[model samples]
Target: MLNSINTNPGALIALQNLNATNTELNTAQSRINTGKKVANAKDNGAIWSMAKMQSASSSSLNAVKDSLQRGQSTIDVALAAGDTITDLLMKMKEKALAASDTSLNTASFNALKSDFESLRKQITKAVDNAKFNGVGLVDKSAKALVFLANADGGSFTVNAQTLSLEGLNLTTALASFSTVAEAGSMIGKMTAALLTATNKLSALGTASTGLDTHLTFIGKLQDSLDAGVGNLVDADLAKESAKLQSLQTKQQLGVQALSIANQSPQSILSLFKG
Candidate 1:
């Protein structure tokens, strides 16, 4: 049986052509405004899915970067405080040697000992107070000195154990040492503690250097990810410019074609007039 719509082929064909042309015109307009061919997942499901995957990876990396930054800052604070403590210990040694002077009596030596003792307390205070975001780096709080991040956005536990200076009890260093031998013994103990601090600081410094290198790599990764995202989403200005020109011309021509198509129906009116 002949379809009822086929009875008026001219009107049906004209309407169909108009709808198709209108769709193309709208697509071109959308691309022009958004500067993206795939504005949403519906544009191309597979390609959009891949872009989302890449986006998810980038997000994970970004989170890692934040933690790495915080770790680096914590190390930096610890490093600075370690340096000051190293200097303080050296000064304390100078005072210890001054106490051993033959001319200095028990009372004079006691004054020097008091100053050295005060410096030791200051060193302990510095360590106890060394904190980044309320997490102590040098105190008994943290077991490790360095933190490393893994690829899956989870932190990989690296052995960064810091040496605890808590056990170096220096209470006796405060009391007056009468004999030169007593002062010398105190100096010896203090020197050993200083050496230990130096060694630990060296280890911490090495770990911090490694973290700095990792941070640099992460920064590069972020840059690469940003460039990749741009490649996927950003319109190539040169290509889009050319496309814009072509679409403009095609739109003008499409309007003209539609105008001409509409005129085909007017021919029936002309026939009646004749």
Candidate 2:
């Protein structure tokens, strides 16, 4: 190779190698700092795009999980109210049966009627208050609760059940037991109301169970998506660290080689001085 003072090819080649080494060292250092192999589209365009899409999917599933949890809470409140109403129905039925006996005096019959009315009123209150997030599933104007099942606007609905006073035929006006016949009829109505409440409870329980199962599936799906994204974009810190050290060493050697190549042109001056 001709060592010329005006243009040193060896120095130019050494400088080019040094620049390439510096570029590689910077990339390894960036991976180490960010802990991601594909931090941006420029790093690995296809892999970065895929990872971003999966991450967005995981976020959408997280919203679904939130909806499921809220739905569970609503169902839980309704179930609890149904249980209390069932208990109140049993007590009201007992009062009605005691009032049906012919031996009971007027005062005793009225006392039993009063207790029955109180218990029936309590059932109405229970149904009225069986609400969560401003939604009552066991009320006169109850509506089905809808929850998102996925990010794509898919949904599940929980049917509402009315357990109000008029719904159970245990309203204040109809709760009187003036005769044995009336008391017996009241007992039958109470039995039917109890059955209705229990059936509603069963349905709500099933819905809650379904929500729980969906939530579990969503959790697993999010985990799988996250793992996939990580696989596509996450950097191997150990490997990057090793690469950074090697590149640093190579960069130092490149600079030294360039320096030596530049000095070669000065050696040409010695030929003319003699």
Candidate 3:
């Protein structure tokens, strides 16, 4: 190799190596600090795009879960109201049976009728109050509750079952039961109403169970999508840590090598002095 005072090829080569090592060190430290192998699209365009799409899907599924939860709550409220109405109907049946006895005085029959009327009004109140998130599933004219089942706008519907007095055939006018004979006839109607209400309650319970299962599936699906995104973009911290140590050592050695290369040009000066 020809020695020159003006230019040192050795120094240039060492500087280039040092710069490369520094670049590698920076990349390793960035991975450690951010904990992401592909923090931006520039790192890996295809992987970043795929991860972003998966993340969006996960977000949509979260919304679907929320819808399912709301639907479940509505069904649960309606089921509770139906059960309470069933109890009220049983009590009303007892009162009707008592009033059917011809031996009862007029005053005693009136008192029993009043209690039955009150119970009937309470059933109406219960059905009206069985609302969740602005939806009344047991109201006299309830609409179907629809919940998103997936990110693609597909839905699951919970059909509303009315549990009101009119729906249950228990809305007979109080004035229509003036005679003990009429009160006796109401027993059969009340029994049929109770059966109808019980069936409606069972249906609502089943719908609630179905919604719960859908929610569980949504949760599991979201977890799986999240894991997939992580696999695509998450950094291996242990590997980054090891690379950081190795690059740091190389950086130090590169600097020393550059210093030694810079001193080589000075040797040409010594030759001139001699």
Candidate 4:
């Protein structure tokens, strides 16, 4: 080619090649720094949009898990109180049996009656206090507790088990151990109350077990969604590192080639030298 003083074709070609290399180098660095090939819509619009949707679902499930856990805890508190009331029933039954001997003196009979009354009051106290997060499941206060099971508006309900003195038909006024016949009547009531309380405890226990099983499933579902999002967007760091090194070497070579092209015009000075 003829040497020209005004323009150098080689320099223009070299500059174009160098600009191309710089663009590739910037992309490699970005993948390495962010660790995601499709961090935004510009990278891969379809994949980015899908990943965002799945991430939102996983986040919503976290709230669902929290609600289920609270429901489980409420049932646990009620179960604990139910067990305490059952034990108190057995003790009250023993007090009534002793008072029904039909041969006890007035002093002994009155003492036994007082003990039975004290134990009866304890059952009421236990029922009133079986609360969690301001909800009493076993005291006839709440009909049921419903917890979120999924992001799609599904739910699980734990029905209340009313185990109070009024619920068990063992009213405070009927608890009279002053006479042998009255003490015998109380013994029969204690047996029926024990049966009712045991059944309620079983129901609460079954609901608790169901909640635990569902929580395990929710955890697994969240993990699967997270993994799917990672598959769609996460970059291969090993591949990006190798690409970065190759691009850095090519960029350095491009700069050297541009410098050589710029010097080509200087050789024309020798052609016109004195």
Candidate 4 clashes between residue pairs 3 or more apart in a chain or in different chains? none
lDDT for each residue of candidate 4 in 159-269, tens digit (9 for 90 to 100): 999888877767777765569889988899899989988988899999999999999999999999999999999989999999999989999999999999999989988
lDDT of 2 by residue, 1-274 (tens): 7667789899889999999999998899888899998999999899999999889999999889999999889888988998898898899889999988889899999999889888887887898888888888889899898998987889988898777887776677776677877997888888887887788788888988998999899899999999999999999999999889899999989999999988987887788884
Please report, in order, the local distance difference test score of every candidate based on alpha carbons: 0.68, 0.87, 0.89, 0.90
User: Mind giving the per-residue lDDT tens digits that candidate 1 earns over 82-197?
Assistant: 88788877888788788888798778888887887778778778787777887656665566533546457455332332433563444443433556677776688678767877
RMSD of each: 4.0, 1.7, 1.9, 2.3
lDDT of 4: 0.90
Output the better candidate (2/3) by lDDT.
3
**In lDDT terms, how accurate is model 1?**
0.68
Number of the top lDDT candidate: 4
TM-score of each: 0.81, 0.93, 0.93, 0.89
lDDT of 3 by residue, 1-274 (tens): 8788778899999999999999888888888999999999999999999999999999999889989988887887888888889999999899999999999999999998898888898998998899987788888899888889999999899888988877887665632377799889878888998899988888888899999998999999999999999999999999999999999999999999999999997777677784
Q: What TM-score would you give candidate 1 relative to the actual structure?
A: 0.81
Q: Output the worst ten-in-a-row residue range by lDDT, candidate 2.
A: 167-176
Tell me the lDDT of candidate 3. Answer: 0.89
Using TM-score as the measure, what is the rank order of every candidate, best first?
2, 3, 4, 1
Candidate 3, residue 172: how far the Cα is off, in Å: 2.6
